[model samples]
Target: MWSLFALLLGLVVGSFLNVVIHRIPRKESIAFPPSRCPHCGHPLGPLDLVPVLSYLLLKGRCRYCARPISPRYPLVEALTGGLFLLASRFYPPGVEAFLVFAFLAFLVALSFLDLDTFELPD
Candidate 1:
């Protein structure tokens, strides 16, 4: 169904948003260098990057470093997925729902960035 598709899409986008939230304020390129374990700077492989499920399966620690990962990662992914499902119900399966998803995603990024840095990026 459209709701399921939207939720999955949101989860994937939320994963990318993690990179955005981490690199944007630091003026780092979001596209290059790929995702890594922050504690060890080891490039993360596919199994290490499965949104909320990976965090749960790994028990919230980096596999490479055994350091605690922030719970915010899964929280954001779930929130985005929830928002996408909600938007799909409200706006139907069309461009409007897609726009709503984009807006909601932008807001989520802004919110976490503000919390993490005490300032919002331009």
Candidate 2:
């Protein structure tokens, strides 16, 4: 189903969003250093990082450090997945999706940065 495909796509994008959310605030390079746990500095294994399912299974805690995880992880995943489904419903395909996705990503980053740092760098 197209909806299923969109959801899977969203999940992947949401995973990248997690990376962006973590890195952008710290002024770290999003590409390098790889994904790791913020509280424990443990390199997160695949099993520990499966979008919404991982957060649910782990009860929103780091497996390595048992630190309470932020609810933002699942929130981002759900938000992206829902947005994908909604966009697919409203728009056919092509540039509509790309444009909306780009804007959504920017808004997400801006919202988080404003909430956490109270300032927007970019």
| TM-scores for the candidates | 0.94, 0.87
Tell me, by lDDT, which candidate is best. 1
The TM-score obtained by model 2 is: 0.87
Q: Stretches of candidate 1 above 4 Å error?
A: none
Against the hidden true structure, what lDDT does model 2 obtain? 0.81
RMSD (Å) of each candidate, 1 decimal: 1.7, 2.1
Local accuracy of candidate 1 as per-residue lDDT tens digits, 50-106? 989999999999999999999989988999998998888888888888889999999
Model 1 per-residue lDDT at 54: 95
Residues 7-95, model 2: lDDT tens digits = 77777787788788778878999998878888889998989889899999999999999999999988888888787777777666678
